[model samples]
Target: MTGDGPGVTLAESGEFAVIDRLVAGRRQPPWVPLGPGDDAAVIACPDGRTVVSTDMLVEDRHFRLDWSSPHDVGRKAIAQNAADIEAMGGRATAFVVGFAAPGHTITAHAVDLADGMWHEADLMGAGIVGGDLVSGPQWVVSVTALGDLGGRTPVRRNGARPGDVVALIGDLGRSHAGYELWRNGIEQFDELRRRHLVPHPPYGQGEVAARTGATSMTDVSDGLLADLGHIASASEVSVDVSLDLLAADLDAVAAAGAVVNADVRQWVLGGGEDHALVATFPTDPPPGWRRIGRVLDHPGSQPRVTVDRVPWHGTAGWESFRVD
Candidate 1:
């Protein structure tokens, strides 16, 4: 996809030029004492404890060039890493990136990716402090995010107690619906298609949940049931998700479901990549959070997650090792 016509390839621009293009004209947040053009960036953690998380996205496996633009891929990469920090009840402060792509790729695309990263980072008042660029056969975006807890306790999956209120903030199943539409070559549902490309993670709700006394917290990177299963197992408690509580989420995707002739429940339950926050609260959840389920004591030795008290046999989440 490389040619002349006002665009230079990475091979033509050279590695240094490509890196310069990515780092140019970008501003850093106050938390970053030093940004690019140095050995490494120095970041400040306000609460003295740093929350760190990292994620990697591969071309074709995690996204398709035909389906997502470089900008969309960049946003997805940064957003997912940010969600990891949010799941730990922290707010992202600084980000370091490592990007690799074919030498034939256009340099402008790499710049676009950086712009997208900066755009997403700026949403939560964070910044891209530093990153590296390299040559590879296919595009790979890796990000390491650092966060600050603001003196709140770091919430974990094992802290969900029986009788805690299980709640969700952000969205569910929209990404799966978008994936279905894209995979089937459907042209309708523009919103769902866009959601598949760029997820909308709840920006500050992690700290809000923490401040409100969340017992357990996690981002729904996999299927809802699969992620909740983590909480259930870690906390050794059964989780019962009420369908009546999820009616709004179900209705939100009902039209897309009918068009694809697929059950929306599976999309909401089994689909992943929405990056929504789900947590168990000891009391009432804060504003904008939806009450979806409740934590319960395990009847036996094993703890599990159920939908309306019934086992879900469909796909529960994304399995990276499974061959599609």
Candidate 2:
């Protein structure tokens, strides 16, 4: 499809001018020492340790222009990266973006993408401090998020103990349901389809968990079981997720499952990109998070992740360079 107006393709506007159009007039937070128009941004970290994570979304692999607009792609990129910082039990402070796209792409689409990025960042009370724009064969959006510790120690994946309880906050299976709806061309579940375009992460909840003495934490960017497997291996503990506890999550997407002839349980078990927060707590989980499992004291022979005492057979998580 052609651009919005002026027929200004990448060849006509060039990279720098397109970036100027994209970043112009965007507001940044006070913690951002330096905003866009620089090589990199400088952000304040009063607590000493900064939490950072990066993710790359390649066109056709991560998203399709036909299935999602540029605006949706931008929001998804920022949301996913922000969730990583949240998983570290930190608050997102700022973000830096690296974007590559075909030289023939419309300048208007690029600007719209940046608009969506800024909008999502504002929701988290963060800033898109800096970014780079370059030409490539297709769109490749990479985002790196920096976060603040807020004087609380970062909750890591390896910190779970034997008796800790597993908890989850945020809806599961929605994005996967959306994907199924889109793939099957089913238009019934608008909410699920929209969720696939832009995820709504549980903002500020990560820092809350950190302050509340959470032991281990991770974002559900990958499938639930796959992500818990990371914690299990790192903490040298076994995790058992109860299907009964997850029935609510399954029921939430049950309608969409029926439309596509897919299993709701598979979506809840294997869906990724929901950006939900999962943590291990020593006591009862705080409000807004539901207890789904418990940590076990097994060593070498413990199951990485299990559902109702059985090993789950669905796909686990996402990877960059996989043929499957």
Candidate 3:
């Protein structure tokens, strides 16, 4: 479909045609009994329980077109939502996306977005079952991810107890380090720059922790302190994080901090969007996780997280209403 000129617009292609392009060559996982083209998608939950989570990414607030390609934005929308299921010790099985953009937006860009979403979903043996498209003021992507627990009880945030060890798997603060590098226009840190645009969450470690008897688990979407605080509050426990245990994580971004004259500790402790899984284990953590702290009985009813036994006075994490 062509518009008045050479470069075709979504307005010219119309809704059904553009959607056809988005789902044209895509393949669905076997669990998807009914994929796109129907009024609804049918996903099989063999374990008899479904793990579900949803997230939204708005233009400019969550991402900048100048900074992220449409493909990058698509990967991010699916990744963040899938991370939520991982936090609950389940594997993502399928996703449904609702995307909105101006009618003038290029149809090819929308197709690229779908391609990026498919690429990330394929990493975890998941599928893009269904979604919707609409014209709006700006780009917005809303994703709902469904997962399977494989008959294991979901590891909750309230099961931690005194003497449990705190552990984490996957990179921490790398995305924030990339954000700093991208904002300051310093192009030396190529990996960091890419991380800011598209995060790489530990894909399958959630089930590993669950199998290893994780008492409580969560993905680090917020800063380490803020996210750990959720577990502490739920479990009525106090947590102490040993910075000495985080030397490798710190060293990973210390050089970037120096280049920007920023505090590396804040990036690691207060930064967010690493999507790394953190959990409490009664014994030694599984092979992929590193012990970073310990859970203790709360001194008072109010639970808290500390770095070296002291409260963090710096920035804690990303506040949704205050994204700037």
Candidate 4:
């Protein structure tokens, strides 16, 4: 009955056994009234509403098994989805995942992936309440996160106003820097390399921003400017980022950029996947958040994001359909 025994493949164990191994011995949070093993999960909605977000990760596009362990991939999947919920100024309460993998994949790897998901969910006091498993040509992980707003109005991208301060909580460009290092086969900068494999999102900061008077907010899943551009377009405003304010982040990745013969500014400005929360505030940002820029009015004009009062010419963050 040991799915991990003898290096069993998912096909060898069949679907039910593989799923059993993944869900076995896992604990659920109090908010999750019903978890896996039921037809559907029952999550508490004390506020009478739930904030939901979903993301899909395909092998070789979002991650590569050769570069990322099953554990790393699992964490990345959950972290990204959780960030979406956080962007709305909510705390994640539960998740429902859908996993597809080649039948030839090892069952142990699948279990490890589940463990990784649980690891991240635990960090946010959430639970992986339910999921589905299926066979495919490659690995595909799709996660849907449900969150609680705690009686606060859900922050939206269109709420940013002119003169609002732009602040961020979490690191930036480290993942892109890590990707560059991995592509060049450089073995140094262990932390940057690890960051590319699994992102570290600032958990609970979303609710803090909302309570602290955040007008608009988003996680830096795409590059900074690109994600901010979303707020600009939705809010009908322009954003100007100050390079002077981002000195610390640039310095953080400068060494890695030099080693990789890349521009550190591009990484900090345009790199994505750090899942950092960037928001617009009317007053002083809360403690632990760094002020980076300000929002501007753009009435009857196309919304834009700028750096140092000028448009940036570097890579504009990741696009789902862009070909290199």
lDDT of 1 by residue, 146-241 (tens): 999998899999999999999999899999999999999999999999999999999999999999999999999998999999999999999999
Model 2: lDDT equals 0.88
RMSD of each: 1.9, 2.1, 1.7, 0.9
lDDT of 4 by residue, 213-258 (tens): 9999999999999999999999999999999999988998898899
Candidate 1 residue spans exceeding 4 A from truth: 1-5
- The alpha-carbon lDDT assigned to residue 128 of candidate 3 equals 97
Those runs of model 2 whose alpha carbons end farther than 4 Å from true positions after fitting are 1-6
Judged by whole-model lDDT over C-alpha atoms, candidate 3 comes out at: 0.91
List TM-score per model, in order: 0.97, 0.96, 0.97, 0.98
The residue pairs found clashing in candidate 2 are none
Model 3 residue 147 CA deviation (Å) reads 0.2
Q: List the residue pairs that clash in candidate 4.
A: none
Model 2 Cα lDDT, one tens digit per residue, 207-258: 8889888999999988898899999999988898998999889999988888
- Candidate 3: residue 59 lDDT (0-100): 98
Which residue pairs collide in model 1, if any?
A: 223-317
Worst 10 residues of 1 by lDDT: 1-10
Candidate lDDT values, in order: 0.92, 0.88, 0.91, 0.94
Query: Candidate 4, 279: how far from true, in Å?
Result: 0.2
Question: Mind sharing the TM-score for model 4?
Answer: 0.98
Best by TM-score: 4
How far residue 11's Cα lies from its native spot in candidate 1, in Å, is: 0.9
